[model samples]
Target: IKGKIKHFMWKCYSGILPVSCNLKSKGIQLDEICKTCGEAPETIEHLFFHCSKSMQIWTLAPVTWEGLQEDTQNFRGWWNKLCTMKASRMSDSRIEMTAHILWWIWKDRNWWVFQQLKRSAKEVVLLITLLNFILHLSYLNYSDSIFLSLILRFSLHNTHTHTSRPIVRCRATMDAAKSPPSYSLRSKKEPYLPTLQSDLKSRRASKADPNPLGVKTSGKPTDPSRRLRNRCTVSKKSRRRTWSFGYADPIHLKRLGMWLNLMIRKSYFNILNTNKLKSRKTTWIGIFVKGSRFPVAIPFATSWDNDVVLVKVSPRKHNVLAMFFVEITSAIFVCLFYRQCLPGSLSPKKAAGKIVLCFSGNGSRAGKGAEVKRARGAGLILADSETYGSLFLAEAHLLPATSVTYKDALKIYEYIQSTKNPTARIVPAKTRIPAKPAPFMTAFTSRGPNPIFPYILKPDITAPGLNILAAWSEVSGPTYFVDDHRFVKYNILSGTSMSTPHVAGALALLKAIHPDWSSAALRSALMTTADLIDNEGNPITDAYGKPADPFQYGSGHFNPTKAADPGLIYNASYTDYLLFLCSIGVHNLSFTKCPKNPPHPFNLNYPSLAIPNLNGTVTVVRTVTNVGCRGPGVYIASIQPPPGIFVKIRPSILNFSRAGEKKSFTITIKTEGGFTGTIEKGEYSFGWYKWSGDIHVVQSPMAVSIL
Candidate 1:
C-alpha cells in the first residue's frame, strides 16, 4: 500500500494522474485527458509543469519563479527550478512556503480527479498560494499543523475571492483567490474566450452587472445637491421690510413650540436691497477718509471692491442686547474678512441711511431660537425703555462730564441692577431704624391700591411695559390678518424684561470706549450719583404710592446725555459688595451653598460689590445759578438720598422770575434718618423749565462732608 501511495502521489505531483488514483492492474491506466484543460492528454509532467497551456497561467501570478529557466518540458525540472529561485533561498522560510503551495495544488488536483470532477486552473493556483501564505502566518504565530493550515487557508480563499464572474482558462492549477489565469496562445485561440466575452457584454447591457461594488459613475446622479438655495430670492421686486416682532425668548421655546415652523421659515426673509438708485453717479474710485485715495467708489460694485454696510444695532430687550451682540458678532465674522479684503464702496447718498428694522425686547425672549432667527434678518437690534435706562447709568459712571444729575445716575443704576442675574440680588431697602432722615416726599399715586409688600419687593424700578411692536412668527396666528391689529406687530410685552436692555444699549455705547471695566465698578458709578427726582420735577419717595419704596427704585431712571456729564459719580470698588455682604451677614461666602474653604476677598474669584461709603453725613454744600442768555425759567433742584438715607431739599422748587444772565441757589444734605453706618453727603444742581437754548447754566462746586 505504501509503495502504491508513493507512486500515485508522484504521478499526481508530476500532473499525470490524480493522487488517489489506484492502478492495481497493469492493463488499466489513469484517464488520459487533463482535468483543467479537458483537451491535452494526461501525463505527470504535462499536468503539473510541462503543459504548454498550463505554463501561461503563471504569468498572472504576483510572484515570479525560477522554474521559467530550469525547464520547458518536465515536472521535476519545473519543481526544482521553482524551489531554487533567489527569492526562495534568500529566505529559507519562503522557500518552504513555495514548496508547500506547489504540493497543495497537486494534492487538490488529485482529489478532484479521484472524485471524478473538474477544477479550473485559477482555482487550483489560488488554493495553493492562499494555503501556503496562511500556513506560513500560522507558523509565525502558533504551532503550525500542515494539514489544518492548508485546509483553513483554502476555505478562507474560496469564501472571500470567488466572484460570480466565470474564470478564464489558465495553467498548472491556478490559485482560486488570484485573478482569472492568462491562457497560452493555443488556449487563447480556443472558442471559450469568445463565448465568455459575448456573455459578459450582454450581462452589462442588461443591467445585471449594474453599478458593481467599486465602479465610478459618470454624469448626474439621482440624488439632489446637499446645499439649499435661499427661497426668498423668488420675489426680488419687493424692497421693504414689514416685520412682526415677537417677544418670545429661546428659553421659553417650549411655550412657543407651535410657532417654530414659522420662526424657521421666516429666518430667510429679505434683509438688504441690492439694487442701487439709478440716478446716482457710479464712481469706481473715492478718497480714503484718512488720507490718499487708494480705491475709488463704484456702483453695483463687485465683491472685490472695498465696501460694507454699517449697521447700528439697538437692544430690543433687556437681556437680549448682550445676546444679540454675541450672536451678530459671531454670525458676520467681520474680523475674519477685515484685513484680507478691500473695503466696500459707500452706498448711494440718498440710501446711506435706510430705515432699518431693529428689535427692542428682553434678551430672555429675544435670545430664543425663534426670536434669534428673526433677529438675524434685521439690520440692528435696539434696547428699549429700561435697557436704555441701565445703559444711561453705565455711561454716567464711565464717562464723566459737567451736569451729571442725581436723577440720571439713579435711573442708570436701576437699569443695571434689574438686568443683573437673579443670583446677584442687592435690592436696597429703607428699614425702620433710629436716626432715620426724613425722606423728601413727593405725591405720585398708584393706579391701583398698593398691595402689601409681596415677594420681597421685586422689580426694583418700573418703566413702560405696555403695548410694543416686536417680531412675530406666522406660525401662531393666521398667515394674513383681516385687521391690522391682528397682524404680529405691536403686541404688548412687559417686565423688567423690556426695561433692562434700555440700560444695556447705553452701556454698549460706553463699552465701545473702555471695554475693560468690571461689572461691579460700572454698577457703582451708575448708582452713586443718581438724583432722587421724579419725572414731575419733584423728589421721588414712597409717598408716590403703588407699592413704592426706596427698595423699588434703587437709584432712578437713566438719562444718557446727562449721565455722560454726571459731576461726581459714586465710583464703587469690589470691596463695597463684600462689605455689604458682610453687613448682611453673608460671611464665609462660597460659590457652593456650603463650601469648606472660602477664597480670600482679594482673589479674582471673589465677587466685586462696588458700593459707596459715607463715613457720616458731614456738611457739604453746592451752589448753582443759571447764566443763560434767555429763559422763562421755573427751575427745580432736588436731592435723592441713597436707600436707608435721608435728604431735605431746601426750596426744592426753583421759580426763576425771568430769563436772566444768572441766578444762584444753595442746596444742602444732612444724614437725618435711618442709616446705621457712616453716611455720605453730596449735592447736585439742576435748571428745569429753562426753555431757551441760548441760556448758559453754571452749577456751583458741590462738596460732601463725611464724619
Candidate 2:
C-alpha cells in the first residue's frame, strides 16, 4: 500500500522525490521475490505504518483507515480503502504528497549507506530551501487544500503544462488548522516503545511572537509581556550628515556641523546655495553694506556667535560687500535663515521720498589742507558742471570749518540765495565732519585746544552706517582698490556726515509715507519724537557722552518710527516770530537817543509798546533824568506794545530820547492776565542798547515798589 501511495502521488512531489524504492538495509524491503504472495510490497510505510512498532503513527493518521478493513497481509485492500475515503480533494492531495515525500526520505537513507551521498530526512528537512519554499507557498495561500492544488499544479506543469484529472492515492487524511509546515526526520531506530498517550503539548515557547511576519530567527522572544519586562532596550541610532569646506558635496545628505563663512563672496555664495538647496526648507536672507556708508556687519556681529544664523547678503549697490550664512540644521532651524539683519544702501536719486544722504570729504586727503580745499572746490564746481539743473542743495552754511570761514561762507551763500541763476540752489545744511586725526574720526581739520564747543556727538544716532564694505568704482585709482590690486571698489568712512544721511534716509522713508508734511513740521516731528534710548536700552548722551545735554543732541537722534506719529508740533509762523520778538523786551529805542520812532520796527504790529510778561525776555535799557523842570508833569513817557503776544505797555507809548543826551523810556510790562502759574512775586525794569543797531544794556530790569 505504501508503494502504491508513492507511485500515485508522483505528481505532488515531482521534483522533490525519486522514482526508485530502496528500504532494504533496514530489513524492510517490500519484495525480494514477490511473484506468489499476490500482494503488493510492504516498503517503508508497510514496514512502519503496518508494523506493530509503528501502530501509533497509523492510529494518528485516521481512525477509520487505521486497521479495521484488512489485516497487515492485505496491502491492495489497504490502498483501496485509503483512496476511497471521503475527504476534500486538497486534503487527499496533501496526504498523497506527504506520503511520497516520506518515500523519498526512505530512499535517501538507503543511498546514504550505498551511494554515500545522502542525508537524514530530518537533516534535509532542516535545509533552508524546505522552510523557504513552505513560506513562499504560505504567502500564496493559507488553507490545507491550497497546498494540495499547488503541489498538483507544480507536477502537472513540469510535465506537460496541460495535464488534467491525475490519479492520486491517499491512505487517510485528518483535518488540521492551516499552519506553517514542521518536519521531523526518522533518525536511528529507537529500541523501546513507550505507551501511546493522547496528551499533546503545544510546541510554542512563552516568548514567541504571535505575529508570524515579525518572527525573529535570532531566538529573541517577541512577546509583549517579555518586551515590557525587559529594561535594557536598544534604540536605533540616528544618522548624521556632514560637509567640509571646499569639499565636494555628498549626494543626498544635509550638512550636520555649522559651515564657517571665511571667504567674502564665496561665503555669501554658500549661504545662497544652501538657502536654496534642492529639496531643502531654508530661509533666504541677505545683508549688504557700502564701503563709504555704514559699518553694520562686524560691530553688530560682536554681540552674536557662530551658532546664531546669518543668511547671505550681497551689497547690490556699488562699492559694497556682504556676508551670507545658512543653517541646514533641519527644516525647522532652516526657517530662521532669512532673519539675518542686513544693512542696505541707497543713492540720493534713488532716495527720493526716502532719506537722502551724501557725505563730503569721505575721500578727501587732509595732510595738505590746501590740497584738500582745492579738491573740495573742484568737487563743488563739478557738482554744478554736471547737467544743467542738478538739485544738490548747497548746505555750505553748516560746514564745520573755522568760524571766520564759516561766517564768510554764510555771506557768500546769502549772496547766492539772492540770485535767480539756475545754477545757484542747493540744500543749505550743516557739515557734520568729525574731529580730525582720531582713529575713527574723519580727516577734517583739528579744532582749537579749548574750542569751548566739541562737535560731532558720539554714537551718531544708529544709522544703517557701519564699516560699509561696498563696491568701489573700479575705474578709480589703485589706492581706492582692494589689496589684491582689484579695481578701487571699496572704502570705509566716518563722521556725523555719515550719521546725518542715515537720518535723511529715514526721513525719505517717512516722506514716502506722508508726502504733504511741511519742512518745519517734518523737522519738528523727527526731533521731538526721536528715541532717547541707546542701542543697549540705556539713555542717550551729549557730545561729551554725558546724559543728554539739550544743546548737544538738539532734540534727540532722528526716530523714524516715532516721527511718523508725532501727536502735536509747535508750528511757528511769521506772526509767531513777531510775538517772540516782543516777548524778548524789544519795546522802544528812544533810550539810545537815535530816534523817537526808529523806523517803526518794520515787521512788528506794535513797534513802540512793551511785550506782555517780558520777565523771561532778553533785553537792554538806558535811563536819562532831566536836570531842569523838576515837576511831575515835566516828565512824560509813552509806549506801544508788539502784536501777537498782545504785549501791553504801562504808559501806552514811550518817548524821551532827548533828555540831556540820555533819554529814558519807562516801559512797564503787563503779563497776559489770563496766563496761569505760580505767579512768583517779583518786580521788573528794563534796559536798552542802540536805537537802530547792535546795543549794550546799562542796567537790568529794576525792582519796583509793590502795594
Candidate 3:
C-alpha cells in the first residue's frame, strides 16, 4: 500500500501524464482548460485539488484536509511538504488516503476528457475507499499478485490489435519455479500463426540442420547478414556503471533471464565510436533502459585511436603481456606449452603501448586483462574461441579490450606469422558499413576424432569466447608472478577454455528448464540444434577464409535458444562413457565398476559421428529420443557425406510417437574405391546426415579420417 502511494506521487512528480497543462506546455495544442470546469488549465494542482468536484470530495474525507484547498496552486510543492508531515511519515493510512483521493480525481478527470463521462463525487470516493479497504484486508504478499492480475486485465482491455499485422510486443508469464530462464518470441509479421512454443521448437531444430522444422511453407531465408545487423542500433550508449552484488554471478549467461546479482558496466560502445568527433576532454555515453522514462549518460576522458599495435600470442603457461614487454625480438613468438602452442609465449621489441593479439581459447579472461593493463600495453585484441568463431565477447566486460571473429583473428595471426610483423587497427563502429561482414572464424580450435578414441567427437559446439571481459581475482597481478601482487578485479581473455564454459552454461540452463532430459539427450539437443552454416546460410568456415570441415567445427556453432526445444535428442548414459574408455583401451581411467560386456565405442550413443580409421568401412550406432510436441516426428535420413566417403544409415526411417520414446540406427562410413590418395595427403573429410521430419530436421556431423 505504501509502495502504491509512492508510485502515484512519483507519477505527478515526473510530469509524464497527459494532463492539459503538460500537453499544452509541450505544444500539443489541445484544449488547455479543464474540461469539467472550463475555468483553469488541467494541471496537477487544478485537477487534483482546485477542481470543484475534488474540493467537495476532500471536504468529506475521513482524514482532516482543511489546509489543502488553501494556497494550493502548486500540487508538487504541496505534496512534498505533505509527505514530510508527521502524520504522513508515521501513519501508513494517511499516505494511502492521500493516494486514493489523488487517484480518484485523476480518474474522474480522464473520464471527463476522454468520454465526457461523470461520476458524482460520492460515487468516486466510494470506489477509492472500497479499493483501499480490500487492500487493507488482503495478506501482505497478495496485493502484488492482485496487481499482476490487474495489469494483465488492463493490457487485454486497452491494447489495440491488428488482425493483418504481427504483434510488435509479446508477453510470457515467467514461472518462478523454473531455475533456467526460458525464451519466447512472437513474430509481429502478418498471416503467420505459429504459437510461440512451436516456433521456438522449430527454430532450435533449424539451428542444427539446413532444413527447418514445423514450418508449414517454404521460402528463401532472409539475408543472414541482416539478422543481427540491427545490433548496432541496440548497443547501449553509456559506460557509467554500478556494482551491486548479492546473487551468485554466472560465468555463462545462456538464458535471457534477469540476473539479480550482477551489475554490468560496458565502456566499449562509446570508446569504439571515438573516431567520429574531434578531440575532447570527456566524451559522454548514455544507458537507456526500455520502459524507463529517463535517460542516463557515462562520461569517459579519452579518445579512440588505431595507433594501437597488435601481435599474436599463443602459450597457455606464461603471462603474455609481461613476456611481450621484455622480449624486444620476434624470435620469442614460438612459445609452446609442453608440446602444444599456447598463449603465454610471445615475441616483440619495446612493444610498449602496442595492442597484443591473443587467442580467445587459450587462457582466463581475468588473468589476461590484468596482465595487459599492468604491462602498459596499448590495448588487447581478443579473438573468439578456436572451435566457435564470430568474435564472441563476454556480454559485458572490463578493461581496454576488443575482439575480432575467429577467422579474422586467424588472418591477423597468419599475417604476423608470414610477414613477421604485426600491424593492427581499430575501426570505429560508426564507420562500419552495413554490407560488409566481418570474418569471424578461428583456425586453431582443437578438433578431433577424440585424440584417444577415434569414434567420439571432442568439441560439442561453439560460442563467443573471443576478447571477453570477466571478473578478475584481485590477489594477483596481470603477470601473476609471486613478486607481482597488484590487486584488481576484472580482466579479458579468449580460447577453447572460454568457449567450453559457454556451452556448459547453456547446457546448465537447458537442464534447469527440462529437468527430465538425460545427459545424452541434452548433448544431442546442443549438437542437433547447432547451426552447420554461417550467417550467409553457407557452410561454417575456418580462420583461413576457406570452408571448414567437421574436424574444425565439431557439430557446428552453438545456438542455445534453439537447443531449448530441439525436437528430438540423442540420449547417452554413464555406461556409454565407460564403453568408450574400454574401446579406446583406457578402461583403467574409471574408478567405478564397468559393464562386463562393454559395447563398441562407435555404438556408445553420442551426438556426433567420427570414423578415424575408415580403412574400408566402419559402422557406428546411435539412438534418438523423441522430445518434441504432440504426435510422432516421422524422419528420414539424408546424408551429405564427406568427400571421398560413402555413408549409409541402416533403418533410415525413424518414427517416434511419444516423449522418451527411443529409436536406434546404424551409420556406416565407407571409403570411396577410386580415391586412393595417401592418408597423409588429405587426412580427413566432412559432411552431415540430417533426419528430415515434418517438424524437425535433426542433423549430426560426419567426419571421416582416411586410414
Best by lDDT: 3
Supply every candidate's count of residue pairs whose N, Cα or C atoms clash at under 3 angstroms: 92, 47, 34
* TM-score against native, each model: 0.22, 0.22, 0.43
Candidate 3 minimal-lDDT segment of 10 residues: 285-294
Off by over 4 Å in 1: 1-462, 471-490, 528-552, 573-576, 587-707
Top TM-score model: 3
lDDT of 3 by residue, 1-707 (tens): 55765676788877666788888889887878887667787887777766656754553343443344344666677776676774554466666767877877887888877886655453454445435544553333575547744753363234232343221121211111111111111112211111110001000000111111111112222222221100011112211111111111111110001111111111111112111221211111100000000011111111122232332222211242333223221211211231111333433343356666556444554345444445444555566555443223422222344555567665655655664545444322211122112223453344443443455554455554444333445545443444545454544444443444455456657755764455456667877987756555666556445675555555777777888888878765433443454555542221122345556767767677777767877777788888887656788999988877888898989888777688889888887778665445336677889988777778888777766
Regions of model 2 farther than 4 Å from truth: 1-485, 488-490, 542-545, 572-707
Error of 2 at 380 (Å): 33
Instruction: Choose 1 or 3, whichever is better by TM-score.
Output: 3
Name the lDDT of candidate 3: 0.47
lDDT of 2 at 659: 23
Q: Kindly list the per-residue Cα lDDT of model 1 for residues 1-707, writing each as its tens digit.
A: 12544565566456555321233133466665666446566556555443422442332222444325336455566656654664446455444544544455556566666775433333444444444434334224434435545555454334223234322111111111111222111122221110000000011111111111112223112122221111111122211111111111211111111111111100000012111111111100000000000011111100101122211112222221222222221111111221111123112231122111112223322222222232232111122232222111010000001111233323333433454221111111111222111122212112110122110111122232211223333322211222212223222222232333344444344333323333332332233323445544555434213233333333344344444333222221223323323333343221101122433222211101111223444332222223222444555544434444444445555555553223333333444465666533422111111111222221111212233
In candidate 3, how many clashes are counted? 34
lDDT of 1: 0.28
Task: List RMSD in Å for every model shown.
Answer: 38.0, 44.4, 23.2
Q: TM-score order of candidates, best first?
A: 3, 1, 2
The lDDT for every candidate, in the order shown, is 0.28, 0.26, 0.47
